[model samples]
Target: MNKANPIRIQRYLSGVDYPQTRDGLVRAAEHNGADAPTLEALRGLPDRMYEGPSGVSAEIGGDS
Candidate 1:
């Protein structure tokens, strides 16, 4: 949570679409158990960060 980056907060709330309502963003953070900083990083992830059916495939396959 780089308290300096408001954009990160905005992105985390709205998703890639548009600025989400404040409440929506708050709920999302709560549901995901994400700290403000972690949520900010997730929001900053590149669009292609996850590819494939569930996005977990890459992580799962990494152990093989």
Candidate 2:
């Protein structure tokens, strides 16, 4: 997996609502256009519910 564009990560997760689990978020990100690296980053995050894109980003090492 290649490195991902941090800014686009949020846009890809647009369809997902808050309180989504890491697995669910990863699926949504895939459905919305996230690449392999982005998916990998999401997968690497701690297993928990995310409140929003920022939460996902923060866990994936973004400047949220």
Name the best candidate (by lDDT): 2
Q: Write the per-residue lDDT of candidate 1 for residues 1-64, one digit (tens) a residue.
A: 2322344333433343223333344466556465656455444443443332223222322324
Q: Score each candidate by Cα lDDT.
A: 0.40, 0.76
Residue pairs in steric clash, candidate 2?
none
Q: Relative to the unseen true structure, what is the Cα RMSD of model 2? A: 2.6
TM-score of 1: 0.30
**TM agreement with the true structure for every prediction:** 0.30, 0.77
Q: What is the lDDT of residue 43 in candidate 1?
A: 47
Please list all clashing residue pairs in model 1, or write none if there are none.
Answer: 1-37, 14-20
